[model samples]
Target: MRVLAGLIVASLLAAAPAQAQTVFAPDDPGSSGQPGGWVNDQWNFLPGTGVDAPRAWGNLIAKGRPGGIGVRVAVLDTGLAYADRGRFRRSPDISRFRLARGRDFCPHAGPGEDPCDGEDAYPDDPNGHGTHVASTIGEATANAIGVTGLAYGATLLPIKVLDRDGYGDQQSITAGIRYAVAHGAQIINLSFEFGTLVSSARQIPLVLSAVKHARRRGVLVVAAAGNAAQARVAYPAALPGVVSVGAVTEDGCLADYSDSGPGLDIVAPGGGDDALRPGEPQCRPGVALRPIVQMTYAGSKHRFGLPRDYVGTSMAAPHVSAAAALVIASGILGPKPTPQALEQRLKATARDAGPPGPDQAYGAGILDAGAATAP
Candidate 1:
């Protein structure tokens, strides 16, 4: 299911906390000589509120990988702007990324009564959702174009399970998961969710089996908790062995629209208004916060811009996927870490938030890439 985009009016005013000794200042083109202008818009990477990405960048650089080099993350969504085929064009920020061969599972409708073709080699995004999600994980860094990605050095594998409208069937999603694992993807990011009505695991047995297959193959699966704003987390994310992620705003509280329950594994910056909770200082009921900003389609697939309407658990899941790639590349977990080990490392290093000690709202806590990859 697609989480509807919302507009963000306010800008972040808080100064980021002290950064690490290794500073990474990249020239930002539109900021008018302001070095690393990405810091102004990408509050999700800041020190205090968001996942301190600069520290993680320094840690990865110290290991000589720079940004999760040698790791592969598969994004299963509505395709991506990773290629230039026919009328489609690649996103400018991610033009230099190492993208693996992707498959298009979206079915094409035939004229009259002809059979539909459901598979293709080119997975160009007709919808911008997949491109936005992929850019967050592997958009090029220090290229002086747009915002930096979290795991910029990693290889991205785009698996188009969802169609143009951000909807997909069980068969396509299952195929996409298996395809990701068999094609050498170390991590898979599922930024879409089934409806909350499909509560039980029996409802999606094929998708469940696919998730288990990824786990058995040593591929980490990260999924988004639905944006239903309810206590129950959605399927695929709620499935066992999958890292279920919830959403938090820039204020560090659970986002008003993020789902929370026993199944949630962690939280990250999803960017929206705060949920009103008693005794929580950051919970502002009506105040709209800044949404996650990345280079994506402006109106058509041919044009690109940094739009401020993207938000939801869909935006939160990629942070964990990129962080997992960083953890693998950092060498702190040894050469080949198991999926369980990577999940535990992320949970252990997260900064605590909401109700204390792994509650439903904040899960283990907001994701801290800096702490997870610290040397």
Candidate 2:
């Protein structure tokens, strides 16, 4: 019986090596895109909303002397997929994109071997969230394909740390952070959050170390406060030396779901109801749970071959990321501004939203891309 059992165990171990590995690659974004000014008379700012309009970042960029013109910003998300409609404008010369690196932290999903597999050297996203976020930060612009980006002139280095489900383990997240810094990425944007606080505490040393290392290398790390809407903060974003961002409405109001605290460095136009009429119920045909306020990207393609709506704190995080790039590109702030100094500059120049001064509800104020870039 023992010999028979041993033989079965050996068989199981040998069969594991035959399993197919999963992989991903970046693909060409669809032809149509937003022009970075205004879509449908309103701004389609958040990810997955799919309306492609000139985002607030556009106004900010226009006012800037010429920010993020020659910089590279790394967007660490699920993956990127350029869309069919003009949700993000294209620029053949200035906007250079690559499926630099990626990993699959989810063991159950499939074998993690996309980029390394050679079958798909670039990471392409079927989920759509990463593509929307990337479009806002650094999609190729003015190619008459998609919507305009916050830093249309900047180059985007896409890295995939999370899986299609939009969740990743700490090890994978840490690896992604390090990889971005190792590459030529000067600005790092992380829009996802994890629930474990103790894990956050455990990861603090590594997170801060990476931040310091990146800063020493003239890189900036920007992350999002958790979308829980509770006062509780999440990892990486909540860590010291990292810039944690919050969300606000178009009228310059604090978003109810945005986390608030000292960690809340600055607020930005995350999303609001301005795109929809008050009584008009923001409904997306087949989706049952309509977001009271649409903020995040729903998806790139739908079952009916259309876009979907996405609303979450995750949606609010990218606006700040783009703004940070502008600050770096402006040359107004000295190169390698400390996290505290960058926070101070942003707050000092922001258009106050909450009470007069820094309050827990709104922090310093909503981010003013224009003012942050003004000489």
Highest-TM-score candidate: 1
Instruction: Give me the overall lDDT of model 1.
Output: 0.85
Residue-pair clashes, model 1: 0
- In the range 140-225, model 2's lDDT, one tens digit per residue, is 44554434456666667777666665655555556666777787787788887765443355544655676677767767777777
RMSD of each: 3.0, 14.9
Task: Show model 2 residue runs off by greater than 4 Å.
Answer: 1-67, 82-121, 196-200, 203-205, 272-308, 335-340
What C-alpha root-mean-square deviation, in Å, does candidate 2 show against the real structure? 14.9
lDDT of each: 0.85, 0.52
Give candidate 2's TM-score: 0.69
Models 1 onward score TM values of 0.93, 0.69
lDDT of 1 at 101: 91
Instruction: Show where candidate 1 strays beyond 4 Å.
Output: 1-21, 29-34, 110-117
- Report the lDDT tens digits of candidate 1 across residue range 1-375: 222221122354345457535635556542333667888888898777788888898889989998899999999988889867789898888854488999987666567421224689988888888888898899888888878889999999999887676777788889899999999999999998887667888988998999999999999999998888989888778999999999999899899888889999999988888999888987888986888988889866788888878888899999999999999999999999999999999999999997779998999999999889987
Candidate 1, poorest ten consecutive residues by summed lDDT: 1-10
